[model samples]
Target: MMESIVDSMLAQETPAPAGNPIESAEELSSIAFGFMASKALFAGLHVDLFTLLADGPKTAEELAKAAGIPLNRIVTLTTALASVGVVSISDRKLIQNSSAAQNFLAKQSKYDFGDYLRYQIDQQMYPFLLQLNAVMKGDLSDDAIASYQHWMADEEQASVYSESQHAGSLGPGRTLARKVDLAKASTLLDVGGGTGAMTISLCNEYPDLHATIIDFPNVAEIGWRFVSEAGLVDRVRYIPGNAVQAQWPGRQDAILMSYLMSGVPGEAVADLLRKAFDALAPGGKLMVHDFMVEEDRRGPALAALWQLQHMAFTPDAHSLSVGWLTEAGRKIGFAVDDVDNLIPAMTKLVVFAKPS
Candidate 1:
């Protein structure tokens, strides 16, 4: 009876027109299996495989012995990694990290963000993605990522998330500091500033500048530790509260909202922009950095993917665009001053200014 039911369903399927037949299904197949590649990369990070290869090349047997895994298991892992160009195996059967892996995945490199990849992206977000369908269909509540307060309720988990996120954010923070001119602005507010990474970067760039970060209490605690480490205790401070509802200090010289928009529900975005406009001094700049798709929303796969990923957590998440922000800012009595890519195609920086 089950076989007949299945056959009936299969018989209802239609074939594509011969003229419109696909040249190849390679692209579709690649995307379908993309998760497997990501898992391989995560597995490599979990095993500290990249770090081990950092010291020098090693044979499979040597790696297995060093990592305390069986030889067959190590070989399988290395083969998967090698296929993805993250690592390479030589004719001599010695393995080493690719240059990109050596730079960013190895623990020894100054630019290494291995913790970010291993902890935040892999362990945290990866598992959360499984519940994405539920989130989209509005079937799930008690979301860990969408509701920031709920997620930060646990101090230990918050520390792990923030610390890894800080590692990922610092480099981009420095990039923003260099790209945007905050030289003349002495006061800045970093709203939803995770771990004060952006503030630290800006303060380091401008010695005269002082930054106040508004975030959840647990998040602020972690930010304070990072600020102390950066020796910007005097110049950098935190206000513990929800950024959307908290009373913001008026007449700020500049405001930064990095990775803030897409994380919040769609309706709150306009309010956030309004808040920034209200908070800024005359001619003050508000920089919004987040995953913004192209105005036409055609390509730039990474940006689109990130926005979609955020929707999995944030049930009412808005899909952002340059046009959307410009329209929203204009309605709030602000002029769009500048727009640029902050992280290549993955994120954008849109600067809006209140009239002086």
Candidate 2:
């Protein structure tokens, strides 16, 4: 009797909903207008809209004058921004940072991710989302190659993201800069360090620690410019070369691989860790910091997706497991400890040490 009842239900055929086509149309319309959101956000950044709104709400004329956008465009930009609730409009007048923007978009928050958003948008990750079809067809899109070569050149030079290391800056590198222990080590080698920001931060923190910034010649030039301007030239030395092929020239009490090693092949990551292990003094510590993944390779959807993209564009791109890294460091005879959630929503840090 139960089998017969189940069969009856299984054999039933339902008609498609009458509103399926309308729902499909609305979805397509939403997809089509998504870029409007991109422009609104970027234009907001371009015009210092967030900065202007920082103080208080302003009339459209005041906002336009402050942001330098034309008066005619102000209404449309405001409407677009407000539609997303970048501002609140009561009495048809403007106010700043409606709840969502106040928390995330404002320049003052620890969560100031707006710069990164605009950077990715202008850097073509946002624009390139539309060209996934082309990318699937092997187009080798600009965003792919651009950031790759940008890093590839650094990898070529053994440079680190040093300049990208300011404590107050807006990313994992900076986050790592502020928290990672820079003391107890007098000589630090920042391999593939970009901008020398990390070195600068460490120099300030440890006072005794001096660092070398190595990367591709051109990128190192930029790092040099920054460090010079930053008045850190005496403490941080910039070296131009490739990390993979060139022998990183220096011995140290400790070595930092901050936010480096992403997209490096599994074997190469092992090799690099081994190299750093050998370079460390008998009791030196090696800090391996990057966007860490869950041990099961789940959760933190964006970082996991990024692990794949890191592989997709670069020649030897891939992510390392923190567990695997700790195990490998142990195999090389380093005492290892895992520090989870160091960078807040971006990375977990792994620490490996060689006893003297």
Candidate 3:
């Protein structure tokens, strides 16, 4: 009787839901196993799997040989990628790169973002997130919290971080160039600019504009190479020191603090805003771009996650919000001209203007 009842239940056909599935245990499971998915992507990128599959479909054996990964291991990696929709497998045992992988992950593609993923996520963030438990418990030492700055003091590591970060910053920099108006501005300041990506983008957009970047010595060294490559050396220069401590060129037409405010301590953010206000020329614009939550601080999932991620390195990092930034800029005697998303929900661009 039990077997008959079970068979009857299995045989019953149910209509599929027309819209999104309801929140359930599956959502919880997906969240719990999220790290495994991240690791799978890292592994595939490390092995150059996407590049191998970019040419065309290949059997598991062919991929193994081409990627120089063992057959069994390649199969395992490909299977995981397939499950994540980046790799597809057919009954004939052929594996192919999904459109997402072919366009963004393949080295031959112009939009290849593998470097950012490999360096920032795999090398840096992966290990950093491992200390979340200790960080939350307040068990970490001051040296541990300051480790990121110490690591950046090394030229080699700084180069690696800046190079990958430059790749990630270029798109947003170009976006800023298109969206923000700087036609009247002649000089600009890029505080904490990494690799001068925004400077290059803006310089490319406005032929007559010149800019100065303030960052660490090692980062400036790396950034010079990028500026030279972009052929903007004549227009762009660097001041190698802490941006807060460095002597900023006074009476600037514009100042940009991309990814700057949230990376520093709470007090430092206010100081930077004041410094930008002081440095800008009358009628100059200060563009502040960084991860920021909405006013209520309830959640924009990615912004919240990025704030948490930064905390893995910067224990005293400020919790940024658009409302707070606007209020701070107002307090510093600047008018908030515009506020909009730079990278959708992840970051915002707030333009503050000094009265002419």
TM-score of each model, paired residue for residue: 0.91, 0.73, 0.91
Candidate 2 versus truth, CA RMSD in Å, comes to: 12.4
Clashing pairs in 1: none
CA lDDT for candidate 2: 0.64
lDDT per residue, candidate 1, 264-338, as tens digits?
899999999989999999989999999988876763677788888777777788999989988999999999889
RMSD of 1: 10.6
lDDT of 2 by residue, 1-356 (tens): 01222223235553122223336777897768877886888888767777678778888889888877898898888888888767777785865767556655667754555655555434434543544455556776666554544644544322233222332232444445555665678898887776676666567667788888666676677678777886777888877776555576556887888656885666778788888888887777788777666676654554565565555544355566677778777887889754655543345678777878
Give candidate 1 misplaced runs (Cα > 4 Å): 1-23, 142-146
Could you tell me the lDDT of residue 253 within candidate 1? 96
Preferred candidate (TM-score higher): 2 or 3 = 3
lDDT of 3 by residue, 1-356 (tens): 01222223235553222225449998889879988888999999998989988889999999999888889999898898899898999999899999878877889987887888988779887788877787888898877775556778977878878888888888888888877899999999999897898899899999989999998899999999999999988999999888867889999999999988887878888899899999999999999989998776765667888898888777778889989989988998999999987776567899999999
Candidate 3 has an lDDT of 0.84
